[model samples]
Target: MKNIRNFCIIAHIDHGKSTLADRLLEFTKTVQVTGGQMLDNMDLEKERGITIKSHAIQMEHEYKGEKYVLNLIDTPGHVDFSYEVSRSIAACEGALLIVDATQGVQAQTISNLYMAIDHDLEIIPIVNKCDMDSAMPEEVEDEIIDLLGCERSEIIRASGKTGLGVEEILSAVIERVPHPVGDEEAPLQALIFDSVYNTFRGVIAYFKIVNGVLRSGDEVKFFNTGKEYEADEIGVLKMDLSPRKELRTGDVGYIISGIKTSKEVKVGDTITHIDRPCSKAISGFEEVKPMVFAGVYPIDASDFEDLRSSLEKLQLNDASLTFQPESSLALGFGFRCGFLGLLHMEIIQERLDREFDMDVITTVPNVSYRIYDKQGGMTEVHNPGGMPEPTLIERIEEPFISASIITDTSFIGPIMTLCLGKRGELEKQNYISGNRVEIQFKMPLGEIVIDFYDKLKSISKGYASFDYHQDSYRPSKLVKLDILLNGESVDALSTLTHVDNAYDMGRRMCEKLKELIPRQQFDIAIQAAIGAKIIARETIKAVRKDVTAKCYGGDISRKRKLLEKQKKGKKRMKQIGNVEVPQKAFLAVLKLD
Candidate 1:
């Protein structure tokens, strides 16, 4: 039996995880298997610079006269998909903890590293991107050893971009990482880590053999659903070549069963021989929960079905994503989508626009809010449409988050002040890596929903790294502010906020909103208020006139045609009672100062 090596690559966002994967594929000559280069097919992934879904690759190498198959799993870096990362780790025996030489370790690095350790994976730390001018390999190495408790010798200095120390890193994988052990004679069992779609081949599930060898044409049943199917093809994902058949124990490969839909395959689902199935499915697979919610609507209402189909296709590959159809009284038809976090939402939107060619309009992201009704019934509302009436709601609790900020010592005071202004409570502060300081605080998720990163970047000069997770919701005196244009409330501008800052925030936001929106032919009044209490107001002047000045008899038809077009265009504009609202009005409310 050949030795088996199963490992995952874990790193912070933009820490060169996918770049290193591409380099390894090039190094092992696996790029030729998929025509020219397989990694090039990851177009959507390349644009984002982060992996939204987990993928596996198998490479063969001979170390010290022993041939071995190395299964490498790439995981998502965004916190929203941390559940996927955990599942990938569960299927692997070790991990290659990649750290950027210049950026060192950030918030995500700490979270993902802890996940790897929780899985009891042997970690082989590597410092990547040493070829860059700002690379600080020695300092980062010291941080890894001191903060992460990684061994000094096991930390390999490599440049995935330049292909330096690639061979030595591979050697370390063979030498330091333990091999997966499988009972070949026992009942066949494998753990599905991920799956993909093909036009001709159907649904192919990528998995690792946990015990016994799985052969082609074997009848297997999924442990989660108890559905049985015949494994028609068993093949490995060759680096640069077509899939080669006959993947054995401890090997990472895709199995094409008769099942054709991604819904049939799930992460952590155990596949076992039907005749002699295992006693129980592998444990430790946790259901991924969404932390942020938003409404996704197509720019063109006619493309609603297209948006739904694209979301379904995305969901097939990503088990962590969740969505449900929703309709707003004012926004029309849309889907209430659940995401891992803000970054996940952006990635999904980008993929929808870039990959599926769909233009989407997304509402501001919101955390789940608790509503205590007057009759004592409590319910959680993730969408504004689901919120109950103010009279029925006794109290509203907003979700708070515990955030950590790592920055230079100089900007610590400013960051703290910014956080405090945003209703953040100081937790603790400390110094790490000798010079860098780490600050922790608890803040309202609502405050950080929009432009938090941009503000932090501006204040810290782009040197601070931030991380936050949902802290428990707390009781607060809050109000649901309704913004009105003319005499009607603009549904899109409605948001939950504290009563104290309602007027100032409302006036500032209305002005910004007015700047974003185009003027109509009539005057519009932008007013912010809590129920009957007026907080702030602004005026959006209307266009003086839209009529054609010269209307000659020869151009009467042309003038009529022009007027007809204008009338038709104005028909698409939202009319709040007697007021004519421009098409840009909906988007304008989303803008924050």
Candidate 2:
């Protein structure tokens, strides 16, 4: 245990966490590096140039003729994947806080740092991207010192691309980070940090042994589910799973028990021997709080059960995802899914399509609200359709977030303008260093759920980094805006909005739907309404045929007769015509800029 070092890498997005990880792997000769971002194995991750999952691998390094075992977990840097970072942090004793030389310390950097500090993990500050011409190593080093209160000599200046200071980082890990401490004689207690599903191998759970030893074929039980199974195989994580006879205390490894159901193995649950179980489960695991809610329905209604199974398997891989059965009048039966953010929601949708071959329609995303009635009965509503009638409601409270944005001084004005437009209140601003500012704001989570991140990125030319956490809920003047098609309300199209911008937003949504909804044989009336009042309306004209053209050169009365006949046909069609809303129309509500 003294020679074992378990640590993870945490940083802001695109700040060289994966690149530095690759350098570390190469330096330790863990794997043959043929390309960059070797740990980001997902194709979507490669396409987006972002890490979506936390990857763990074991490596061996020889220092001064003494062999050492290093367990390195590379975590995603995006704010949406902060839960992944938290899980990785929990399983490690230390973290490498990587900061980009050009970008300095951004919002996510500060947030992730705070999480590490909260976990009491030893932080080793490292400045990456030192080879770039625009790199500001000195300024970034000073910023790191201010953020972490670490000495200049302790901070390592390195370039992930050039492989500089890789050896020093390894040496620091061996010298600075404390070895994992636990008792091998105690009852077996392993904390399962992550797991994955397999068709041939059943479920594979990756865990860190906190106490005692886990051997192959041992009878193990999950603490949360209280389900027991024999360990089919036990191994340590390398580029691949390397079989081990036994994993003792302070060892991170994987165990397969031929567990067919995903529910049997829960992330953050404790694993213990059936004969001599641990007295208590491991604590300090925080539950995931979803920031956005949307309905995910199958494109074909009959595929509902398949969608449910697909989501179940997907949830096993992404424990942060939460869902329950829900039905929509407009979209039929589906699940109301909770996601960390818009990007996380999009990625899940894409994954469902690519991985499970499940074609799904995702409704407009919204945040959950607390609805209080006149009788003082309170209900939590995640979907607009689930909201009670206006007459029965007394007040509605929406979730708010404390958002922190780090950007250049030049872009502060536009960033503030954007936030203020979203009904955000400026809390305070501080100068992180010369010309770099950190702006704080208190904004409704609903305001930033859709396009705020994209807008911030575009306005700042990708120079700004943003991070946020949920704050207390506040009572607000909110109204439910319903979209109607020919006097019929579509439950899926309804949304809760602040009264101040409801009218304008309703108008924009009606116009946007007018462009997205395909033209029917009869006119389609798209109206945005608040209760009995129609606040905005747009008409999608019918696809009319030239009925009068057949009577060309006819008398005016004859043309009028033919037009009158067509008009009667259209009126009949309108009465029975069901508007088939294209899938794009449902998604268009998100882009109402």
Candidate 3:
């Protein structure tokens, strides 16, 4: 057990954590050839150049004739998966904090640093991407030392691309990262950090053994569900499966039970032997809940089943992805899906298209609102279509977020402008490094969850990075803005916005919808309103013609008759005309700023 070292790599996106993992695998000879960021084996991951899911693998390395077991866990670098990072840290004894040498500490890097600290894990700071032409190892090293108050000599510099400091990194794991401690003779207890649904093995729970030992014949029970299943198989992941009869304490591996679904074995659940169950379940097991909600509908109503099947397959791997059958009068059969954030929502939508081959349309993402009624009744509404009437609602509470932003000195002005416009409350501002600034703000989740990231990138010219976590709900004056076409409300076009900007947003939405909606045969009314009161309106005129055709020398009577006939035709068309709204029109409202 002293030779076993369990640790994970934490970093901001594109910091070469996966590359470093590949090098570790190569140096340790875990595989014949180098993995080359092969830890990111998902098709979508390779295409997008980002780690979406956290992965774990076991490796064996020897130094001075002593064999060491290094179980390295790779985590997603994006802030959208902070919950995953927390789970990964809980399953290990230490973390390798990777920061880019060129970019220094980013928004997510600081956030991840705090997570590793909160877990009380031994942190090994390593400056990655040292081979880059723009590498500033000294500047980044100073940043790390200042942030963590560690010795300047303690920070390690390495290049994942060139394999520099690879051996030292391995040695650090053996010498610095503490050996995991657990009682092998006690009750079998394992912390499940992740899980997957396998066709042959059913639910394969990826766990780190915390106490006792797990054998193939043992019947295990989930602490949260209180359900028991036989351990059909047990193995460790090293590129591929390495089956074993037993997984002792301090080992990280998978337990194959007949459990067929991902929900059968949750990510943060503890599993123990049925006969010798632990008196108490492992601590630090947190249930990940979704924060962002959006309505996902099949482009073709007939493909709803396919969409559902696709989402199920995805949910098997992604425990945080949630969905329930939702009926939309405007969009037909669909599901109300909950995601961690915008990137998560994006990945799921992309997966449905690539992995499931289902074309789907997603409504504008929204945060859950706490609705209070006149009679003291309270409710939560995620979809604007489900909001209670304005008169019935006494108050509304919107979700707020504590946000952090890191940017170069050159872009501070624009970054602040964009943030304040989003109803942000400045909390703190300071220079983290010589030319880099970190800003903290408290903002309404509704404001930034939509296009705040995009706007920030545009203003900073892609030099700024952002990360935010959900905070406590704050009371706010909110209104549901509805779009009307010829006096009929479009359910999908309904959205919730702060009442202060409702008039301006409504006017802009009305204008954008008018520009996108094709001209109809008759005059169409495009109105944005709150309840029955129209806040903004635009009129789309019908196609008109001179009707007095080939009038060589038209007299007053002839022209008057032609005009009267044209007016009558316009009236007839208005009575029977039904404006055909294009799909793009509904989508245009999403981009209406």
Candidate 4:
């Protein structure tokens, strides 16, 4: 145990975390780099150049003639997966804080650093990507020292892309990171940090042995779920599965029982000996809670079962994913799915299409609104269609977030203008090393969920990094903006917006729908309304036909008679013809600018 070191890397996206992981794996000879590059196994992650899931691997190395065991946990760098980072940190004893030398310290850099500190883990700062021509390693080192209060010599300079200083990083881990401390003779207690589903093994839980020994024949039970299963197998990760007869304390590995589904084994669950159960479950284990909610439906009603199966398969891989059955009069059967953030929602949608080969329509994303009625009752409404009637809603409350953006000083003015446009209130600003700045704001989640990130990137010219967390729910003047086609409300196109922007949002949506919705035989009047009052309207002009074009030199009265008859027929058809709204039309509205 004295020679074992457990650690994880923390960084913002594009800071070379995965590249560093690959270099470490190759340096230790734990796994071949397949050309000295890719460490991410998932095709999507490779294509996008980002890590969506946290991965753990056991590596063996020899430093100073002393054999060492290194457990490296590679976590997602995006802010959307910060919760996964937190869980990974809880299972380790130290963190490798990686900063992009060119970008200096970013918003997610500070956010992840705070999380590491909250866990009280030892941090080793590393300045990565030193090979870039734009690298500013000294400024970054100063930022790290300022934030961490560590000595200047404590910082390590490295480059994951060129494999520079890779040996030094490994040596630092062995020399600095403390070995895992636990009692191997104690009763079995383990943490289910993550899990995956397989047809052959059912549920395979990835765990770190906190105390006691778990063997192949041992019967184990989960403390939270209170279900027991025999340990069919145990093994550690070395880029691939390598079965072991037993897993001792301070070891990290995978366990397979008779279980076959994700529902049986949950992440953050505690596993212990069934007969010799520990006094109580491990502390700091909590189920993932969702922050964003949206309705998802199949384009075809018959695909409902297929969609259900696909969601179940996805839930097997993602413990934070939540869903339940829902029905809509307009969209038919669907599910109300909850996600940790907008990125998670998008990734799930893409996976459904790419992995499951299913075409699904997602409704407008919205945050849960707290509805307080005159009867002194409170209710949480996730969907606009599920909101109470306007008459009964005394006050509506929306979720807010405390967001931080780190960027160069030159772009601060434009970024602040964009944030204020989204109803953000500036709280504070701090100057970091050189011309970099960190600006904080309080803003509604509804605004941020739509296009805040995109706008921020555009205004900053891609120089800024952002991170946010749910702050609180506060009362707001809110209203539901409903879209009506031909004077009929379309439930799928309804959205909740702040009352102040209702007029302009209604106008923009009405005009956008007018452009998207195809013109029918009859004139279609697209109107945006709040309750029973219409705020904006647009007309798709009726298809016109030359009723008198065929009239050559005939009497003018004859042409008039024909035109009169055609007009009467058109009025009759307009009364009977029903406009067919397409699913793409609804999608266009949700994706409106």
State the number of backbone clashes in model 1: 8
lDDT of 3 by residue, 1-593 (tens): 99999999999888999889888888888875544578888898988889988999999998889999999999998767777788889988899999899988776777777878888889999999898999999988988887888998778889988999899899888889999999999888898888776668676788999999998878889998899998888989888878899889999998877886555666777899888789887887666777678899998999988788778768877878889998877789999998887788888888888877888888878888999999998899888999988889989999998988888888988888888988999999898757888889999988876777767867875567676678899889999999888888877778899988899989998888788878866789999999999999999887767577766585789888878887888889877876766756655665666
Instruction: Answer with 1 or 2, whichever has the higher TM-score.
Output: 2
**How do the predictions measure up, each by TM-score?**
0.85, 0.93, 0.87, 0.90
* lDDT winner, 2 or 4: 2
Candidate with the greatest lDDT versus the true structure: 2
Whichever of 1 and 3 has more TM-score, that candidate is 3
Deviation in Å, model 1, residue 56 alpha carbon? 2.0
Q: lDDT scores for all predictions?
A: 0.77, 0.91, 0.85, 0.85
Q: What is the TM-score of candidate 4?
A: 0.90
Q: What's the C-alpha lDDT at position 364 in model 1?
A: 62
Tell me, what's the RMSD of every candidate? 4.9, 2.4, 3.9, 3.0
Candidate 4 residues 204-262, lDDT tens each?
A: 88999899999988989998889999888899988788999988888899988868555
Please write out the lDDT profile of model 2 over residues 314-334, one tens digit for every residue.
988898999999999878899
Candidate 1 error regions (>4 Å): 32-40, 76-84, 199-201, 239-245, 299-306, 401-411, 428-440, 453-471, 546-591
> For candidate 4, what is the lDDT?
0.85
TM-score of 3: 0.87
- Among all windows of ten consecutive residues in candidate 3, which has the lowest summed lDDT? 583-592
Decreasing lDDT order of the candidates:
2, 4, 3, 1
